[model samples]
Target: MRIIKWVVRLLVLLAVIFVGGAFLLPKETSVARTVTMNAAPEVIFPYIANLRANQSWSPWLDRDPDIQLAFNDVPEGVGAAMSWQSEHPQVGSGNMIIIEAQDPRRLVTALDFGEMGTATAYFNLVAAEGGTAVTWGFTSDNGNNPMFRWMGLMMDGWVGPDYEQGLNNLKKLVEGA
Candidate 1:
C-alpha cells in the first residue's frame, strides 16, 4: 500500500510539472528556413503566393500523397483558402488562408492547426546572389493555453525540420522550373 501511494504521488507530481511548464514556456513559436532558386521572384512567388500551385512543391504533399485537398473562394491572391483533410497521423489536419500578400514579393497566411487555434505564417522573396532567396516562416500566438505554452520547447522539434525540408523541396522544384 505504501509503494502504491508513492507511485501515485510521483505521477501526480509529473502531471503538475507538465502543466506548469506549459505556462512558463514561450507563447510564440517561429520557424524559418531559406532556399535559393534559379527562378526569379516573379516565377517563384506566384507558385507559393497563389496557393493553387502549392502541391507541385509543398513537402506536405509528399508526406501524405492521398491526403484529400481542396480549395475554396479560390483566386490567384490573398483571402484565398486551401483546406486539407488526412487520416495520416503525422500530417493530422489544417486549413491555411492567404491573409495578405504583395505579388512577387511577400505572402502571409493564417494557419489553423485545429485544436491549437490559429497562427501567422509568412514567406519572403529576396534577390539573392544567384537567384531568388526564399524564406518560409511560421509564427503562432499560442494565446493563453498553458499546455500549449509549455509545448514551446518542442516547437522547434516539431516545426523546424518541416520548414527546412519544405524549403529544400521548394528549392529543388523552383530551381528545376
Candidate 2:
C-alpha cells in the first residue's frame, strides 16, 4: 500500500512537471530556409504567388503522388487558395490561402491543417549577389495547449528539412528554366 501511494505520487508529480514545463515554453514557433536562385524576384514571384505553379516544386507532392489538390478559380495573388488531401499521414489534409501578395517582394499565406491547427507561411524575395535570395518561412502560435507548446519545440527539426528540399527544388526549376 505504501509503495502504491509513492507510485501514485510520482505520477502526479510528473504530470505537473510536464504541464508546467509547457507553460514556460514559447507560445509561438517558426522555421525558415533560404536559397539563392539564378533568377530575378519577378521571375520567381509568379511561381510562388500562384498556387497551381507551386505544385511543380512542392516537397509534399513528392511524398504523396496521389494527393488530390483543388485550387481556386483565380489561382494567383491575394485570395487564391489551394486545398489538398492525401492518404499519407505526413501529407495530411490542409488548405492554404494567400492573404498578402506584394509582387517581386513578398507573399504571405494562411494555412489551415484541420485538426492540427493553423499557421502562417511566407516567401520573401530579395536581390542577391547572383540573383534572388528566396526565403520560405512558417510560423504557428501554440496557444495555451500544452501538447502544442511541447510540439513547438520540435517544429524546426520537423519542418526545416522540408523547407530546405523545397527551396532546392525551386532553385533547380527556376535556374533550369
Candidate 3:
C-alpha cells in the first residue's frame, strides 16, 4: 500500500516539473545558417526566387523524392507559393508563400505548417569580396503553449543541420552552374 502511494506521488511530481519547465522556456525561437558562395548576388538570387528551382537544391526535397508539390501561378517572386505533401514526417505537409522580394538582395516567406504552426523565413544576401554571403533563417513564436515553448527551446538543434545542408547544396548548384 505504501509503495503504491509513493508511485502516485512521484508521477505527480514529474508532471509538475514538466509543466513548470515549459512555462520557463522562451516564447520565440529562430535558426539561421549562412554560406558564402562563389557567385554574385544576381547569380544566386534567381535560384532562390523560383520555387521550382528549389527542387534542385533544397535538402528537404531530397528527403522525400515522391513528395507532391503544387506551385502557385506566380511561381517566381512576391506572391509565389508552394504547397507540399509528403509521407515522411520530417517533410510533412506545409506551404510557403513569398511575402517580400528585393531582387538580388533578399526574399522573405510566410511558412505555414497547418496545425503545427506558422513561421517567417528569409534569405538575405550581401556582396562579398569574391562572391555573396547568403543567410537563411526562420523565426517562429511559441505563444503560451507549454508544448510549443518546449519545441522552441529545441528548434535550433532540430533544424540547424538541415539548414546547413541546404545552404551547402545551394552553393554547389550555383557554383557549378
Clashes of each: 1, 0, 0
Predicted structure with the largest lDDT when compared to the true one = 2
Residue pairs in steric clash, candidate 1?
Answer: 22-150
Task: Provide the RMSD of all predictions against the true structure, rounded to 1 decimal.
Answer: 1.9, 0.9, 1.3
What is candidate 3's CA lDDT for residue 153?
78
Q: Which window of 10 residues has the lowest lDDT sum in candidate 1?
A: 146-155
* Decoy 3 TM-score against native: 0.94
How many backbone collisions does model 3 have? 0
Note the residue pairs that clash in candidate 3.
none
Can you tell me which runs of candidate 2 are displaced by over 4 Å?
none
Model 2: worst 10 consecutive residues (lDDT sum): 168-177
Full-model lDDT for every candidate? 0.83, 0.94, 0.92
Candidates, ranked, lDDT: 2, 3, 1
Candidate 3 weakest ten by summed lDDT: 144-153
Give the lDDT of residue 109 in candidate 3: 95
lDDT of 2 by residue, 37-127 (tens): 9999988999899999998899899998899999988869999999999999879999999999999899999999988999999999999
